[model samples]
Target chain A: MPRFILTFTLLVVLSAGGCSPSNEQDKLTVVVAASAQFAFRDIAEEFSKNNNVAVDIITGSSGKLTTQILYGAPYDILVSANMHYVEVLENSEKTHGEPFVYGCGVPIVWTMNAEFDLDSIASYFCLPDVERIAIADPKNAPYGEVAVKYLKSLGIYEKVKGKLVFGESISQVNEYVLNKTVDVGITAKSIVASPKLKGKGFYRELGEDFYIDQGMALINTKTTHDLKTKFKAFVQSEEGVNILESYGYKLSK
Target chain B: MIDLSPIWLSLKLALLTSCLLLIIGLPIAYALSQWKSRLKVVVESFVSLPIILPPTVIGFYLLIMFSPENAFGKMLGDAGIQIPFTFTGILLASFIYSFPFMVQPIQKGIESVPDHYKNISYTLGKSKFETFMRIILPNIKRSVITGFVLTFAHTMGEFGVILMIGGNIPGETKVASLAIYSDIEALNYSAAHTYSIILLGISVVIIIALNMLNAKKRR
Candidate 1:
């Protein structure tokens, strides 16, 4: 009975491998941090139009994606909001090589309320109607860690801790802030620069002191597939930096 | 990736919820069963609403009510008490979420009992409370146990309401279900599997116990 079962399993595996089609080869999957989603989508769309490969971008909290990759999730590239996750993966030999910095992540305090004043941003927590403050989950998202750091830097994290609501991702934080569930949200500057979200809220950027860089990495040496390599080359090209800059990413300085 | 804290948290939450529901549910169920007023229908509808109302609906409103800017929350705040993102918050959400589960079964049992038992005990010089303890209590023992077990299992599997009210703070409010979700999100499938199996096993055992108790009563 065991022998028969093993033969059947072998047959199924071999047949499945043989039946795989060319469309699978025509695709490249890139996992991205939620904060870099909009710009990466733009890059993927542009890349796919010129090249015949289907560029699939998966976005989530960078830490969560790193955990996934470490557990052997299939992906061609990983773009993280924090270079730290990439560095960990590279050290663990999960990536082809050391990750390259693509852009600096900028933090911002955004409010969808038109009546709110951005002048005294540090003291905005004391505003009478400022009830909930939404930030990404600091344990998993880089923007969340920066939000916590920035709040502590301003010396108000303790006072405002009670009002804080943590979203699972920066995208979720944006939703909570935009829908007025939270009076203030800490989000990425890239999100605010997106055309759909621009001008709907007041935003003040956290300066150079709070800046962190986004890192892009080719997954593993086995990801040496031509299409994946081409995509990596295209992103590192000067035009790719320009595209990132247009989307509010500071390539350098 | 794997932590027994979620299991312990879930057990603690379920235990507290079931015990509190028993104490809190009895009076409400008795009042609902014995009330002679026309508006009792209105009150009963309010009690039964949680059973039909989606967890998300209750969670959304509870989240709003618990917000510091809101009136109810402000009242709690003035007392130097906070509800959201605390163990107390989970306790409160569980009480409300599992109230109907505990109350409905007992209420049905109380409502079905004839007036003669109470009347007969009352004529023998027993007070209302004494007659309730002596007569009504024993008659409805099976239903009360069912209510407790049902509430226990229901609270164990509770996810959405916990998500909205509890906010997944580890050790404080991250119960087993949310822990499983966090595990899977982080791609820790093994931990997720372990948590899921534990929940599934415990729920089936509790439910089977409930069915056996009910079946014994029927026999």
Candidate 2:
């Protein structure tokens, strides 16, 4: 059995070498959204243990990664913060199959130094004491867009406009709060759960109305059929859902 | 194709930051050149700290220092003057980030002025301040101009520091570099390309003009 397994591995390696000059290594590369780094890293390590494939995870903002995919960045899979990019890629024929809703994201009002009082937050908007409030850039980041929506719904977008600070990503928004650059920050709940912000800060859920539906898709043109199917199945499995849940994300029912 | 806001903001920031850096940097540079104290080494090292450290490190420290909860920030908050996420914040970060560009060139200029000229000025009954203003400054006019142009260009290209502090607000703190980053990140490549080309063009023009000014000064 050991000799047979070694022969099979050698045959697979030789076949991969003959298949393509560029992709001679036959590794499965997955591009994930930067905010999902911690969760994906853990998942990828576990997945790599049982599979013949080596996973390379490239993390960045979903919009930026989408643009990179459009510009022909070679990746087998893309996990994004919003489903819009997956739909865009599907329409553009970039994905092998339909995008799947893997998890959902929740926005949280996070503070580094103190527990945020939601009841007094509305009054704090007009207060002279609260100088800066950090949010992700709404244009490219989903969490920032949700934060903006919540602020607009509360009718204080314009009142607190001057005191707003925009971070490039959810991680950056956490950095702004962690460093005390902003009095309070609205970021992804995943960021608030990270070890960096664990004891230093606290977060309050922004509710389902402001939730962002995070999704994933396999890039059809660049990926192998077997690897793509494996990745898709892995993410939809019970293990993936548990991992997502552990990261402060809700699994899509 | 012409979104003049970033261009205008970049130029305005470059001009304002260079001017302020000159006011603050020149005296420090001059003092460093004249003095021979152990503290001078420490102070000079501090002045060049921004140049050596990564811009993000400087930006992060500035973010904490200027935020409303910090001591300096609390004082400024009491005065109705918020620094982080404002145009003033961008200016301050730009000044610190680009300090060495102004000071180093001017320091070299000052150091290159012969001690004989200073002795001659003193012999003619001129005070130290008057001698520096008249004799030393004029001889190093080219260096000062070079410093100003270099500092201005450096400020125009600032990204990490400004992004950390400026809040990326349009027509306020959003300079061209940050705008290009935003455009690229949003998949608006056409806008990003346009902004990048314009930025490159402006930088080239400024560098060429500075060169011409230097050539003319030399002649």
Candidate 3:
């Protein structure tokens, strides 16, 4: 049938064209969650320095990126904030192989007040002077969902409910804390670990067992590229773990 | 379950904001209409600033401005009056965001009236405020409605500034737009769909009404 021939020809053409590249082997596209942006940028930079491939990284909330992928966005790999999004792609047979757990994200109560330093997160909540708290919007941000769980587990979500504000992402929450627009906010440890924001605030890791597991998937597509596979392996390698740890991600066993 | 709370919150905000803008915008627009100076262009441009800038750009600065670290925010904080994450913050942000929508139409409305009508009223000994109430405002009723509708609709769809400055607390800062966004993020497409329909209905109704008024004016 023409339909079968059309599908076959399209697949062959797609495989023949490696990401609309200027050259066949030089282009790779990876979609990274907003939370993993800095780490992935560094990883991609290092990878391109050694390999001939030029990597392009697209970053946004994992859910939004997942929606884009489902709509046939030409990403070679997706690094999501949690496993749920990766599993969605896997269930649809859109992933080339099994997704791997790379890191565990830690949530923290961060503050910009110079004098209000504490080693624990609980006290930051009860400070009478601290009226406005910040967290990522819980619906799309895994860190926000984890933040909500951590607050509830601590038995303080209700009491602190009135004072809470929501950011669009972990990065915005970092801005709220660093600008002191909020008294304290729950944010990803990775944000504070970023070199630009490091030492700009006081943070106490929630260290609650409710960490969001980070996942990466090699998307199934007609494009011929091994760079995403290499980047994935590099992300799980010892050097990758070291780089992630420096950016405040807990190593996954 | 169908939650009407966010929709209700959005209406209440739009209602309150439009009312405030109507009360506050008239005098400001009036002053701008009659007053002319070398700095008038600067003032007019300042009023038009929100329309040109991206909402997030304004939202980001407003978030910082409302922070207690700044002088303005510090004063508010010292007064036990917090602006960030509050309805007041949303109202303030909405007022600034929707200011042009309110002012421009009214300014144009006031300008549309022929100067002879006001002069005729003045010749009969009508005061400035009296002339405005009797002569200018009567002719500009359509423009006033345009202002209110545009401001109301603009506030109803406000997302960026509210998301930046608001804490998204339920029944406080979480308006319908924010609710719909969070619903999409939660993968609750059905709820988001419902909210979008209602919002779409509102926008359709508003545009229809405005067109009707505009049509009447043309006649």
Query: Which of the CAPRI classes, incorrect, acceptable, medium or high, describes model 3?
Result: incorrect
DockQ of each: 0.02, 0.01, 0.01
Interface RMSD of 1: 19.3
Q: Which residue window of length 10 is worst by lDDT in model 2 chain B?
A: B181-190
Model 1, which residues run further than 4 Å from truth?
A1-253
Structural RMSD, model 3: 20.4
Q: iRMS value of model 2?
A: 25.1
After superposing candidate 3 on the true structure, give the runs of residues whose Cα lies further than 4 Å from its correct spot.
A1-253
Candidate 3: count the clashes: 1
TM-scores for all candidates?
Answer: 0.52, 0.51, 0.51
Clashing residue pair totals per candidate (backbone < 3 A): 0, 0, 1
> RMSD of model 2, in Å?
20.6
Model 2 misplaced regions, further than 4 Å: A1-23, B1-219
